[model samples]
Every structure is written in structure tokens, then in C-alpha cells.
Target: MTAITINFNNVLKLSDDQFYQLCRDNPDVKFERNAFGELIIMSPTGGETGKCNASMTADFIIWNRQTKLGEVFDSSTCFKLPNGSDRSPDVSWIKLERWNALTSKQREKFPPIAPDFVLELMSPSDSLSETQAKMQEYMNAGVKLGWLIDRKTRRVEIYRQGQQKEVLESPTSLSGKDILPGFVLDLLFV
Candidate 1:
């Protein structure tokens, strides 16, 4: 039998809580643009984030090993900000102290929190502005650091609380001095 899709534009009628609740309740459901007033799932790499996500996951582990400060979250799991938005950063980190502050239940449920740092890697089909807006949202929600990595240009856009966006192009490495001192992201893969 053929399946029928509902219009997505009506998604805004729901509070962010409702949408995620829907996601939780129906894990098998596929949300699409204009099919329901919602942000549609665009990742087709068998994951929401793509190859860069895989690379970042490796970087996350290296950072954790060196700094011994936090844990990394995968895209399969999500970090839900307090503002009713859910974003699975390509890879994310939560400081050990703050992460340990949560109850077992809080850890199990959507974090209702933001990561200490978030990273987004550009995909061929991604909307740059939408991604930028999301990065801003992460900052507004108290994310301490963020990175927007553009592979095509071999550039990285750094986001911090007080500094204006810093663009590093054709760079040899990426750092986490203030965020995760001594951690380095070798751009050799890009």
C-alpha cells in the first residue's frame, strides 16, 4: 500500500516539545519539508551528519583522551536545548562536572541542555544560512564554543561568546585552547 504524507508547514503549530515528543513516540517516522510544518531530515548518509561527522567523532575522542575533561555525544543521541530545540551536533561535548550534575533520568531523557561545544561540518546540500542560524542559537543557549567547518574552502569559522566570528582558511590545524586546552584538530583529512 502507498503511504500518505501530511503537510509539514503546520509544524510550527506545535511547540518544540511536541515535535520531539512525536519523534520519541514514532521513531520510525520520516519528517519532510513542507510535508509537515517542520524541519525535515536531510541526512542520507545513513546518519543525519555525514563524513565530517565521522571525522569529528575521532577528534572528540582524542580531545577527551588528552584533556580528560568530558564526554562526546553522537548524532544517534540528541542534545535538546532548554528552548525546545533539538540538535545533534556533528559531535558534542559536555564538561564532566556539568554532565555529572544531571540525574540518571535527566541523562536518559533529552538533555534539556546544551553542549559545552558544538561543531557543524558543511555538506554539499546543506543550507549555509540555516546552519549559521542554528550555530547562533547554540550560542544564545549558552554554548561556550562552536565551529563551522567548511571543507570546500578549507576554512573554519570560530564562534565564542565575546569574539567576533574568526575565519581561518587553508589552515594547517584547529585548536581548543580555551575550550579544551592542548587539543588540536589536524585538518589533514580536509
Candidate 2:
């Protein structure tokens, strides 16, 4: 089979529902828009490209969930930011009761709400400025907590409501103090 060449300049259009439905059929595709509406498609990172780093993120979220603490979502989905923009975080968690507050339809939509916490790990192709901007947007939109995980640096930039930005390295615990009680993410070594 011939490889498909992606022309980033071309416009890619889809309604929010179209994008959600696409996810069900093709979990391997990742979508993002440029300044224009062109939806850039790339194979979702996996195997070696998505190895240790992404899995570390998964491990953290899973630990929280298995402890029956929260629900987690990965980059296989997108979200509506309060500023009327859309974004995809590497991993996120919604406090159980708050998430269950959604109507069936609301749950089916773009989740119309922010996660109690979000974790974004840098892929090889991700840009620092872009990822940081995303974390800021999430916080400004009332997201209680956010983490920008640097795979290459093995650190995370932690964000919280009404606080200064703090970069944490190893041996520090990632906490959801206000948003998630009894939650401590000890992912320094990861």
C-alpha cells in the first residue's frame, strides 16, 4: 500500500460529534487543528514511540483508579476548554461523584467539564510552549490541578488554582490537595 501524504495546509473540518464518532472507529488516530481548521492526523504514539513515558502516565492514573479514587481518560479523547477552544491532554482524572453529575447526553458530549486533574506527557513531536499553553488554559478554565510531564527531563510542571507555577523533580509527591483528597501521586522515579 502507498503511504498517504498529509498536507498540513489543507483544511480539515468536522463537527464535534464527527470527531467523537471518529474516535470510536479509529482509536489509533490522533487529531489536532492548526491555526486553520485543518485536522492533522497522525498515528497515535505506541510501542516504542509511546513506550515508558506514556505508560508511566497510565500507571499513575491507573493507580488512582484502582484505589477506587477517580476515573481516568487518555489522549484518545479531546475536551472543550472554557475559552471555547479544544484540547487533548495526555491523561486526566475526574472525581467520581462530580463526573457522575453529568447527564447522559452531557457525558456523551465533550464532557462539558474539566478534570479534577490532568497529566500531559511530552511526546517526541510535542512543543514545550504549546504544551505549557495548554496546561495554562486548563487551569484558567477552573481545572483544579494540572501536570506537564517532561519525559526527557523526568520532571513535571505542576499547576493549581490560585497558585504560582512550580516545577518538581524526583522524590516529590504530586498532590491533588483541594480537588482530590487523600490523593498523592508519587511518580518522581517514573
Candidate 3:
């Protein structure tokens, strides 16, 4: 199923704490909030998508471990963006310095910073338009690099700050470029 969005602005608006509590209260649900205060309920990925996500996340973790330049986070970790939106990418990374700047309490809850890099792997249930919009949101929130990968179409859209997006078709791999020097994502698994 595709994601379902609900607008509660007319009835009640959830504060940051309340949104956290809502997520905590519903452990089984994957939730996201738009800058307009609409709640998005996302469906869980299928087996193939899950496996691909795990592999991609593992690659990021291994790369981060070797470089020690950033912290890698899986899909479950959400960040509060500058535009009042709360989003969780399939995989995300924050530079070491940026991550270290967060206070303990801030780190304990949703991180109040945009990830330096983000990757979104499309699942059967995902809408391309919606996912692209989300990527734009990330860029607007100061994400330096982002990737939208569609395995079905063997397409990759690369987003960089202050530059036009580049689309690659059936590429064998992806480069991390300046943002993640020496890091390359092998698309074979996808």
C-alpha cells in the first residue's frame, strides 16, 4: 500500500514532544510529518526492499567506520528538519562535527539537524513523485547530497546542493564524491 496522509491541523496540532510521544506510543507504525503538520503513515517494505535497504545501510556503516568522518543511521532514526518537518531517510549520515554539536538531550530525541547525506530506496509501495518531493525537502533543509534509487527502473537521481540533479541509468555504481570521499555504492545488489 502507498502511504496515507492525514491532516489534523483543524482539530489539533502536535508539538514536537507530542509527535515523539505519538511515535513512541505506536511502535509498529512508521510515521513522518510534513512541514505543513500533516501526518504520513508509510507502509513497511517488502522482503526484497528490506534486504536491499539492509545491504545499503550496511555499506554505509562500513564506510563510516573506516573513515570515522561521520555517523551512519538506518531508516528508523528520524530527524527534525529546519522547516519543521520530521523525516527518516532509508539511510542517512551526519558529519562527525555536526553530530558532536548536538547536546545529549537533543541526541536522545529526534536530532534537530539535517543529514549531510541521504539515500532513499524506492519500494513497490512508494510513489515516485512523493519520494522526489521528499528529496527536495531534504535538499532545502541543507542536505549536501541525496540519492533516489529506483531498482525497478534501474535509475538513480543524484541531488547536490546548488547544482542540478543528475540522472543515471543502469549504472554499475555510485560515487560519494566530495561529501564522502572514497565511498562508492555498488548497485549490483539492488
Candidate 4:
């Protein structure tokens, strides 16, 4: 199923702590909040999608381990963006310096910083328009690099700060470029 969005800005507004508590209270539910304070209830991915996500996350983890230049996070980690939105990408990374800058509490809770790189792997239930909008939000919130990968279509859209997004069709791989030197994503396995 696609995500369900609830607009409660008129009747009630949830503070950051309230949102966190809501998530904590509902451990089975995956949640996100838009900049406008709307709540998005996300469904769990199917087996194939979950497998793809795991593989991609593992790739990031391995790369980060070798480089030691950043920390890699899986889909479960929600981040509080500068635009007041709480988002969780399929995979994300933060520069070592930027991650070290966070207070212990901030790191313990929803991180209050944008990731240096973000990746969104579209599941069957995901809406392309909504995912694209989310990617734009990440870029606006200072994400240096982002990727929107559509496994079904075998297409990828690359987002970079201060540059228009580049779309690749059935590419064999993706380069991290200057943002993640020596990092290349092998789309063949994905």
C-alpha cells in the first residue's frame, strides 16, 4: 500500500518531542512528517524491495567502513531537516565532522541535521511525484548528493547541490564523484 498522510495542523500540532513519542509508541509503524506538520504513515516494503534495500545499505556500510570519512545509516534513522521536516531516506550518510558536531542527545534522538548524501529506492507502493518532491526537500535542506533509483524501470536520477538533476537510463553503475571519492554503486546487483 502507498503511504497515508494525515493533516492535523488545524486541530493539533505535534512538537518534535511529541512526534518522537508517537513513533516510539507505535514501534510497528514507520512515520514521517512534512515541513507543514502533516504526518505520513509508511508501509513496510515487500520482500524484494526489502532485499534490494538491504543490499544497497550494505554497500554503503562497506564503503563507509573503508573510507572512514562518514557514517552510514539505514532506512530506520529519521532525520530532522532544516526545513522542519522529518525524513528517512532508504540510505543516508553524514560527513564525519558534521556527525561529530551533533550533541549526544541529538545523535540519540532524531538527528537534527541533513545528510551529506541520501538515496531513495522506490518501492512498488511509492509515488514517483511524492518521492521526487521529497528529494527536492532534501536538496533544499543542504543534502549535497541524492539518488532516486527506480528498480522497476532501471532508471536513476541524480541530484546535486546547485545543479539540475541528471537522469540515467539502465546504467551499469553510479559514481559518487567528488562527494564520495572512489565510491561506485554497482547497479547490476541492485
Candidate 5:
């Protein structure tokens, strides 16, 4: 099903607590808040998409476990970005120092910080342009590196701060570059 976006600007804007409560009240629905205070209600991913997401998350988890350089989060974790948008990247990582700097309560809530690196895998129901825009938003919010992986097209769009997106065609793997240092994403399963 196509995700539904509701414009909440006409209504009294919800406070941060109210918004978080709304999410808590609906445990099954996935929700996102845009910079404009619009609410995005997304449908659950299909089986194939879930499998790919799990693979990607596993890779990040393994890398983080070995390197002990940062904290890794799956798709369920939402982050309150500086621009006042709450976003949940498919896979995200924050530097060790940055993660340690957050207060326990902030860490428990949507930790108000942009991730150092993020990944977005294209699902069948997702629109490419929308995903691209989301990646750009991440970059604008101070993400050091972001990857928009399109399994169907066998392509990847790499987003980085202070640079244009770099596209790659049908690569076997993706290097983490300077940001992830020594980390690489194997695209075979993707």
C-alpha cells in the first residue's frame, strides 16, 4: 500500500510529548514527522523488503561489534534531527563519542542528533524520488555519509555533506570510505 501523508499544519501543532505519545498510542503504525510538522504514516514493509533490511542491519551490527567505533541502530529507531524533522533511516550509525555525549533520556527518546552515517534501501512500494529526497534531507541535517541503495536497479546513490551525490551501477560491494573507516557493505545479498 502507498504510504499516507497527512498535513497537520491546519490543526494545532502537537507538542513533542504529544507527538511521541501519538506514536506510542499506535504501536503497529510506522509514523514520521516532516520539518513542516506533517505526519507520514507508512505501511509495513513486504517480506522481500524486510529480508533485505535485515541483511543490511546485520552487516552494520557485525561491523560495529568488531570495530567498537560507534553505535548502530535499525530502522525502528527514530532520530529528531536539528531541522525539527523526525526520521528513521534504514540503518544508522553514530560515532562512539557522539553516542556517549547524549543524555540517557535523550538516548531513550528520539535522540536529538543526526547520525554520522545512514543507509536507505529501496523497497518495492517506495518511490525513488522520495527516497532520494530523504537522503538529501539526511545530508542537510549533518549526516557525514548516506547510501540510497536500489536493489531493483542494482544501483546506489552515495550522499555526503559538501558534495554532490555519487551513483554507482551494479557494484558487488560498497566501501564505507573515510566516515566508516575500514567498513564495507557487501551488496551480494542486496
Candidate 6:
């Protein structure tokens, strides 16, 4: 169930509008774009992964609701990154001020900014190397904090801006640290 990647570096490159239209026309296939304009097609995750994704998304949503700090986005929300890639993290959040900077139309379409925080949960179909690369891309695109959670391994890779990635094994919880003050992720279920 590994995701397929189509290299478009030599092929005809899709324009931003064309890519948007392609996504809109094909609602069933999940697609992503790399900085090199390569197309990534991913299949739907299995039930276990779906449940885990939902629970983690709910955690971020609840925190955002309580703090009113920023906008929270689920996996379906794609972002046009500064590097020209289109990515969708499992759970993402942006600072209120930064989000406010975008106009209504910008908000209506795929957001044109990287999130302040991003989270990715590994599914059975996902490859660890590919996921790690994606997390690195997030950091390079201005994500302040990112987490790569592998439920099967019960481990988490913490990625922070201008810092080395830290791997934690079998942790029961994760702190938001300075990036997400007063927030913590209970990973008991994950």
C-alpha cells in the first residue's frame, strides 16, 4: 500500500491553477506535490490509522477552541508551501496573527503558508523514510514544531526549527513546550 510518486520534472509541469483543478476534480484520490513538482498519490489509510488520526485531530481542535490562539486544520486541508509544494499534515495549526494576514480568498483556497505546528501520524501504508523526509520539508518550510508519531513503534520524532530532531521512545505524553504553551498531547491511545 505504499504511496506512488510521479516525477514531473521532465514531464509537463502542472500550473498552480491546474493542480488545484485536478485536486477538485478528483475527490477520491489523495494527492500531494513536492518542491520539485513531483506528484504523490496516496491511498486511504486503514481503519486503525483513521481512528488514530481522528483522535489526534480532535486533540488539536479542542486545544485551539480553548485557547483561541489560531486556526486548526485536519488532514484534508492542503497548504501551498513557500517552496511551491502542496502538503497536508495530519494536524496543523497557525498563529492567529499570521492566519489573519491571509485574505478571505486565500483562506478559501489552499492556504499559501506553512503552519506554526504540524503533526503526522504514520499509517501502515506509510514508509518511515518518506515520512521523515516530509517532516524535514515541513521544518524547512518554516514550521516551528513538528511531530512524526509512529504508533506501531510507539515512538515520536520531534522536529524543531534550527535544532536536531529528537527521538522519544514509548512516551505517554508530549509537551507542546514553548511553541504551544499550556498544551500537551496525551499519547496513551496512540
lDDT of each: 0.72, 0.68, 0.97, 0.96, 0.90, 0.93
Off by over 4 Å in 2: 1-13, 21-27, 33-43, 46-49, 53-69
Give stretches of model 3 more than 4 Å off. Answer: none
Clashing pairs in 6: none
- The weakest ten consecutive residues by lDDT in model 1 span 30-39
| Candidate 5, 1-190: lDDT as tens digits | 8777899788779777788888899989899998998999887888888999998899889988999999999998889999998999999999999999999999998899999999998888888988898898999999999999998899999998999889999999998888998998899848
Residue-by-residue lDDT tens digits, candidate 1, 123-162: 7666677778778878887899998987876778899976
TM-score of 6: 0.97
Question: Per-residue lDDT of 1-190 in model 2, one digit per residue for the tens?
Answer: 1112244344656666765676567766665533334455644554543665566566666677667777788776577655655566777888788788988888776777778788777666666886787788889878888888775677789898899999877535676676766667666445
Per-residue lDDT tens digits for candidate 6, residues 1-190, read 8999999678789998899989999999999999999999988999999999999889888988999999899999999999999999999999999999999999988889999999999999999999999999999999999999999999999999999999999999999988888889999958
TM per model?
0.80, 0.75, 0.99, 0.99, 0.97, 0.97
User: Which ten residues in a row are the worst by lDDT in model 5?
Assistant: 8-17
Per-candidate clashes come to 10, 1, 0, 0, 0, 0
lDDT of 4 by residue, 50-125 (tens): 9999998998899989999999999999999999999999999999999999999999999999999999999999
Model 4 lDDT, residue 140, Cα: 98
Measured by TM-score, how close is model 2 to the native structure?
0.75
State, as a TM-score between 0 and 1, how close model 4 is to the true structure: 0.99
Question: What's the true lDDT of residue 1 in model 3?
Answer: 96
Q: Which pairs of residues collide in candidate 3?
A: none
- CA RMSD (A), model 2: 4.4
Query: What would the C-alpha RMSD of candidate 1 be, to one decimal place?
Result: 4.9
